[model samples]
Target: MTSAAPHLSILDKPFVLDLFAGPGGLDVAGHALDIPSLGIEWDKSACLTRYEAGLETLHADVSAVRRDAFESLPPEINVLAGGPPCQTYSVAGKGAGRKALAEVKRYIERLMAGDSDEEIDKDLKNLSDPRTALVLEPLRYAIRATRSPNRDYRPYDIIVLEQVREVEELWKHYAKVLEETGLPDGTKYKVIVDVLDTETYGVPQTRSRAVLIARREGLGEPSLPAPTHRAYEAKEWNRRRDLALAQVHQSTLDEETAPEPEARQERGDDLQPWTSMGEVLVTPVGTHPGRDTPFLVRSNYGSSSDPGRRGVRSDQQPAFTVTGKISRFVVFQHLDESIVYEGARFSMNEAGMLQTFPPDYPWSGTAQAQQVGNAVPPLFGAHLLSAALGLPTLAPEALRKPWQPATEEQRAKLRSHGCGAADDCTARCPRPE
Candidate 1:
């Protein structure tokens, strides 16, 4: 139990558990907000990263974790936050894309049963469900154990779920499960996309991400906080300039401008493409004559890899989605002096800064670039939490920062030391600082 002297003038800090916390990006985000974090990650590297960052890490697969794990924590954990490994929905390669998305849905199904609705519905067997009976059995047990006879108040008041766009339907499904299972009767669980700009949050990159939020019953619908940055048209959404909880500054007209097809079933132009790589990735323009890394020297162009790829644009338009694979695509390749980081090098920390991590935040670990690529941006979490608590997010520092890029000499030195040769290593990340 963490007790504080009343004279200290601080409320008991909210506790957060990061499920499938890869590389502690979510943990850092919550920690920056001053929340106590307990992270569960199956990957050893991620666990080490979380541990190094001064977080409590449970080095075990979340699937293997049970309710017994919760008993080890101090009661009164106010928040549950994390994005489970998103292998199931990611549209990648031979592409073992997002494998967990289907599993999450199955997990939700099992945990969603109620006191009276126990009649297992049929026909669900054919469909692949992530949140299945097997996956969510423990959560179901946790809910059942908290019934009238047992006084286990296992009700978590808030949850910050971060997932992909395809998972939006999953949100509605999750909402339904919570309602039918009576999880939301006394709790408030809602999911909304809080797309905070990395640049606005003082990160040099123009990255974007989504956030999902939930509050235990009686806390009321959690506040959906607004963005602070305006880079790449985000600032334009500040119609009223309500700095406290201002929403994204983008025009909803882009959405309204989208010609609604005469038919309702048609696919819409995918929401104006997210901030692209050309806007963030370091170009090779200023790179040393001989120190050009593959990423640094890539052409300033899109790819044939995409269904209908667009070529390079001299105008700094959104380049394309910056996936985990940057050197392969989503990069400004070729030799040019004007590329963003052209001829210049970027550190893992610098990449993270573009991803919107706080400067003083020690991201201790090797394979820093890869770690930065895989993480969920922390500012997105900050925006969501700030919204839920109705707290002020007037900090200007979180929205913008000076860009940091590696010099040719530094890149040459690192390459000489064998750090540049193996750019694509799947090995474990180093300990977080």
Candidate 2:
């Protein structure tokens, strides 16, 4: 007798299990889309931020969680998403993951060969940076889910994974592995892998992330979401140069005759110009509220090729990639080296806003800058999740709107039961008594 076909429709509710989830960037998107999500994060500071935001979280290492724990959760999880720790592979850090790429590939081979977890764990411990092995945890979860012996087992309907651009090769290998090793029930996955630029999706930063999306065969082949905004171009800044001079050199222009560049302008064919720092930081989102002056950002860290020359970008451009060191960047009024902008360094809220998080997102604990910088932009995450589920993309206005604040009751709970109390306490903090 033939097994029943898997349910493959957007109408089916999607419950997300995000591994290595950091401060609810994707969870914020999930909430906006009205999807319930649970994130597993290991960092105390990140978990504290999640608590402040009222997002569901489990404060434990991804490797320590058992598949049976997931199997026991109510409502059932059908979606798997994660942006694993990328410092080892990032350009900003020592290239430990890059050096270990071949060894990592060998580990994948062992996993495919049905090697015991004990053997894999022993070898992974021997890697230069043990964190490099964490990238493979998602794959282990996927494999176990597909080959489950449980009578009611259902493999994830959608899988989304992202990392720094260097991990694109690994994601490609994952595509090959999933295709070659079909599900135990003979259903296969159609996978798409690519590097996505956040600015193209209307995020206010020009960050790129390697993304992989997989869906079961009956769900149809997955494709990357189409860009809804034009990519940021340096030439675009030249067009706005005179306007910046006008803001600084002359009185404010007449509102009716010459309006400040609108937050969004329609180009033909459902695309808008890339969002600028001025639109987010200077205007509506109000990183520098009530300030109409144009400014320039001086990056603290110079480019790889020119370490001596500091990188500079006008407010008209999308921000240079916001890194963990974002607090070190300095802002100036126009090109005048002598005049510092009133808000010289972006506040934590401003940095978070540039990452497409709401301005009021309650960032908690030390290393808040690192938390904001490491997060996936919620707007970009929303678009990816929508595309993976074959649903309509979120409205452009959704990106601009502020995220809802946590309820008073939720705030009281966080205050009363702090995440630092203990590991088990943090885990229980977000759940109902």
Candidate 3:
């Protein structure tokens, strides 16, 4: 059936099964597009958040799930999308990819050698690796689903996987293996892999991920969606400075003149500029209670000058990548005209907005910040899945509308009902002046 929304069609939309799903970003996107989807997530906190968000979730390790569970589904899932826990392969993880990939390679070898799970578990027991061979679980599911021993063997028609940029080479290995071994139907997969920046899809955060898209032979290969926003660049810094100067001048000229929305000047003709930090902050411009000023906290006492170190982005620029350690990134807030950096970290709500989750989204459980940081922005995930489904692309304008924050009553409900514990909730929930 066709969707009521202008950008989606559900007539041929595939049922999606997302493995290692964190906080239901892909699942949320699927729901938004009217595609049926289910998520498999093992983290208790994350699963609770999924439950709170009203997304279907199965709490279990990807390695432990059986294939029959998927194969017997009534609608028969045709799309498999997931982001394996990528810490082992992220650059931030200190060269863990090399060691982790070696383990994955060995796991693949064991599978090829007909080693039983008990045999493999015996050898891998002590590894307790955050996700040593876990990334291979999706591939295992794909292969077994296609090569089932039953009379009705229907392979997953499409697979979309993502990880840190460092994992690209490992995904290349997967592609190579798939190329050599055709499916049970004896048809090879057409694989397309790339490193995509989340900002390109209008996500306010400047995060990059390694993406893998594969279609079983006969289905047309789908291209990655074109970027709807310009990536953050060195040149944009100057534009931000000029705009800040104009706003300062305007404020100086007449304090009563409301500051022009900092966001309006950042837009362009065809491609909208990247979503900015100012656009998504909880307090609107000139309305912040304390000092109404914000600044970046780039580093601490002995940070060793890592450029990737968490820092402040101008209101005109997109936010820095939101990492699992997002709670530590300080946001300076001025109180009584005195800047205090003690506890102004971005709230869970603000962080969620930076990742493009809707304002009213319910986030529950203990690890709220990590779940938000780990999630693929659902809006962007929708774009990727939509492209995979061969649906018409939505214009940048449609996706780039202004973000709205949850109201005070809504925020109160979230806080009183015990949503995830936010690090700087005290700073975030000061009595509205």
Candidate 4:
């Protein structure tokens, strides 16, 4: 088993409180970093998976949780992280949040301007999708942690947030607010926001997310994680495929066919090739019974350019964005498109693996597909968290390695940091034995 690189402990000791945490994607990354994490999620299905995995969890709605509630936890949470529900903002959904982007920004502006929750909630309740307003919840918590006059005002040292790419503008607005809000000590947060491709972070799917990372100025400069892997380009892949075909035909007439040069130069001096689905699914997970036979995946969703046509990807390429409806995707033997592959679709374990979850991850409860799809791939989350803390970049091999379950020592450390100890937890918060 390959071990992760030595963790560079930037913070004295970090405790993370994740909001709208679904099935512990970021939390898993946190565990790998030896950082204790507590996730608050409202989805019973996701919570079930969390419990089965023995992750620290508070199964409750983010909106219902008080902004200042972190004050009461046993250990002071220095890191605030979460990926808020992005259904309303995602293009695959109704696009209600996109439609209300301006209105939502106004709500964020009001929150930063000291608008009362009652006032914001009143108007927010009228949005087409109330979930659109929930995007502001992280900011609400941040404001209270930094500015609230409650006893012992302790500000978070770091704040990390992620959402669908459509929410990049809102994340920029968040960066603006966080940079302007100074802590009691007059030190402000250094903030950076960008749209990150999961594939660049070594995830086997090509999902894009808007990410914001902010660290207290005293800690050090904050920046997004550098991509460790080159992003996969479909056009480039197609071009290479056509060239290979042409070369094959010419080789019959000529004595020899010139070797195809590298398909494309690496994105960076040190970046590795983009990870393909075949690298993960074909060998480790055995998606195809014929070990040598390649396969093609027919995506359930359509592309922006061709809405009527279903998207297709070869096993040699990274998967299209994994979605809640991924179960609807079909797989075919590469040589025969008409015949469905033995494994027509991804199993729950296979689906979770595509999202960077461990193959043996315990996925319980209903809507398991949604749980897998909605997760921030743990591999990407690890790199993001490492960058936020001003730590060394995770080696590409570390990100690509299969996830292992938390060790007993890791569980003990989490308990020391107050995992699974929420007083108001509405669901089963299982303690590691």
Top of the candidates by lDDT:
2
Candidate that beats the other on lDDT, 2 or 3, i.e. the better one? 2
* Worst lDDT 10-window in candidate 4: 423-432
Clashing pairs in 2: none
Q: What lDDT does each candidate get?
A: 0.46, 0.76, 0.66, 0.75
TM-score of each: 0.60, 0.84, 0.75, 0.85
Per-residue lDDT tens digits of candidate 4, residues 1-433?
1113235656888889898889888988887778898888877678767766779866666776654354554347889899988989988788999999888888877877778878877787799988788898887787667554552567788999999999999998877866785533444788888888999878888999999988887776677787877878888777777766677678878754533323443444677777777777766532323234477888988897566779888777788998888888887775453455545578777787788876677787899998888898988888888887756665544434444555656544433333343222323333222
For model 2, what is the C-alpha lDDT against the true structure? 0.76
Model 3: number of clashes? Answer: 1
lDDT tens per residue, model 3, 200-306: 78787778888887777777655676776767764556665666666666886755342343353345457666777666664542222221345553322122247
Backbone clash tally for model 2?
0
Off by over 4 Å in 2: 1-11, 67-75, 147-151, 183-187, 235-270, 284-291, 334-342, 411-433
In every candidate, how many clashes are there?
Answer: 57, 0, 1, 0
What's the candidate order when arranged by decreasing lDDT? 2, 4, 3, 1
Better of 3 and 4 by lDDT: 4
lDDT (tens digit, per residue) of candidate 1 on 213-285:
6555555555455434334443332322233122223335332222211222122543233333333433332
**For residue 260, what is the lDDT in candidate 4?**
31
Task: Point out the worst 10-residue segment of candidate 3 by lDDT.
Answer: 422-431
